[model samples]
Target: MDIPAPAPNGVQLHAPGVAALREAAVGLETAFLAEMLKSAGLGQHRESLGGGPGEGQFHSFLVRAQAEQIARSGGIGLAEILFQSLMEARK
Candidate 1:
């Protein structure tokens, strides 16, 4: 989607691309959070003793789940702010 720049006049609250923009924003936030979770998980000693190949295999799934949950719970408000900014820019 070609997200336009903000207009001098203002934003149109009911723009056609608003929904898509919001969805994209949420997706971006979810991916960002998932990457962060993955990075944080990398520091743990999961491969020391009991951890097997399965632990490494399922790490991405776990991170995705946690990131989705976090996003559903307001997600640092990045999605909302992004949605608004995109909407404004589309004006």
Candidate 2:
């Protein structure tokens, strides 16, 4: 069954069962990993050979995409734990 959830634009959208929970869990894990990567200087520019303003401007997007890919590829197991927690909370 679909459950009504609020979207960012204030629209009511239907969240479809476990799939939605899994997606959300993965997203959360991605965000967490992205932040961790950022803290670890994954996308930081180097003083000597930096890509300049453009690279600085879009480094976050690259980091986030990388993090998403990692999450989708089984990640550090955070997504699975989060998915299980979400499933338990929904009950």
**Estimated TM-score for each candidate:** 0.68, 0.77
Model 1 pairs whose backbones collide? none
**Segments in model 1 whose C-alpha atoms lie over 4 Å from true places:** 1-15, 42-45, 48-51
Q: Quote model 1's TM-score.
A: 0.68
Q: Global lDDT of each model?
A: 0.70, 0.77
Query: How much does each candidate deviate from the true structure in C-alpha RMSD?
Result: 6.0, 8.5
Candidate 2 runs further than 4 Å off: 1-15
Model 2, global lDDT: 0.77
Tens-place lDDT per residue, model 2, 5-91, is 234233223445767887888899999999999999998887677577777888899999999999888888888788767766776
**Count of residue pairs whose backbone atoms collide, per candidate:** 0, 0
lDDT at residue 18 of model 2 (Cα atoms): 65
lDDT of 1 by residue, 21-62 (tens): 777887888898998887876424464667876677676777
- Top model number, lDDT: 2
**Model 2, position 29: C-alpha lDDT score:** 91
